[model samples]
Target: MEDNSRSKNRREFIQSGMRLSLALALGSVSGLALSKVVKDEYVWQIDPFECTQCGRCATECVMTPSAVKCVHAYDLCGYCDLCGGYFKPDANQLSTAAENQLCPTAAIERRFIEEPYFEYIINEDLCIGCAKCVEGCTAFGNGSLHLQIIHDICLNCNECAIARVCPSNAIKRVKAENSYLIKGDFSKEQES
Candidate 1:
């Protein structure tokens, strides 16, 4: 009788284990379905028009180095040698010296385009999305320097951490097909 009871207990345990495994699989599938829906309909993006350059994009994101980065609208850019986006407003001199650079990371690289026109290129890897350059450019230049979310790096969290803390309410969901709210059109580069 004792042996029979032991076998019955073992059978009950096995049954319970099977039930739990089925439940877990069903739950996982539902989660995957929800995520798929989100991916298909929308993606996280920043509205450059509403952005106030409040310096939160760098710190509010879940990632150590936030997914947001600076992008240049070259069409709107004057390509000035002394770029407001590149140099500090009160810079002692308009040089590439660390002290004179507006960006803390020196992410904006100034390349000589011609006699006085210097192209500013963003190294996304080095950018921290502090928006100091954005602020400077908007104040003094053509407002070509804008912060954008690099979708490749962005996790598209269901509730974006940066969006929650954004002072200007700039971050929002946009359609996957039209994910970017670019200040300067980049279609010409894409065509080439």
Candidate 2:
């Protein structure tokens, strides 16, 4: 009878240990799965259409020199002699000279591709997110020049500083694949 009792206790103990081990394994697997699901659901994105050009993206961001910068849509652009993006609206006339240019750093390079056709290029390193150029471009031209967040420079913080202060609610989290160079109009397809 004592032997039978001892064997029964031993079986119970073994079964209890096995149950505990299985529970722990299952808990670990569930935790990993939950984390992956959360990670896959979140991403960062900026909307160009609703942006207010507040200039907060330039200064408020945690990254040094900020991830926000201006991008030019060459296809939508007319490449005219008078580029609204490069010149101040109040300027007496459009000219390549430094004083007339809207960009504080003169970061935009204007090259003549042909008669009445000019190429506008942004020097990303020098841009300060002032939006002066973008504002100029959008006002009088084809709305080609616009602000974009450079992912390499972005901190990709849990909550973006720019999004917090954006009055137009233009910045939001989106999937990583569809992130950059968001052109405002759907009619204009991605040009080669």
User: Which one wins on lDDT?
Assistant: 1
Please report how far candidate 1 places residue 1 from its true position, in Å. Answer: 24
TM-scores, all candidates, are 0.76, 0.75
Q: In model 1, which runs have C-alpha deviations exceeding 4 angstroms?
A: 1-39, 186-192
lDDT of 2 at 4: 100
How do the residues 2-96 of candidate 2 rate in per-residue lDDT, one tens digit apiece? 99999999999999999999999999999998787744444556677777777787887787777888987677888878888888777776778
Cα deviation at 86, candidate 1, in Å, is 0.5
Each candidate structure's count of clashing pairs: 0, 1
lDDT of each: 0.89, 0.81
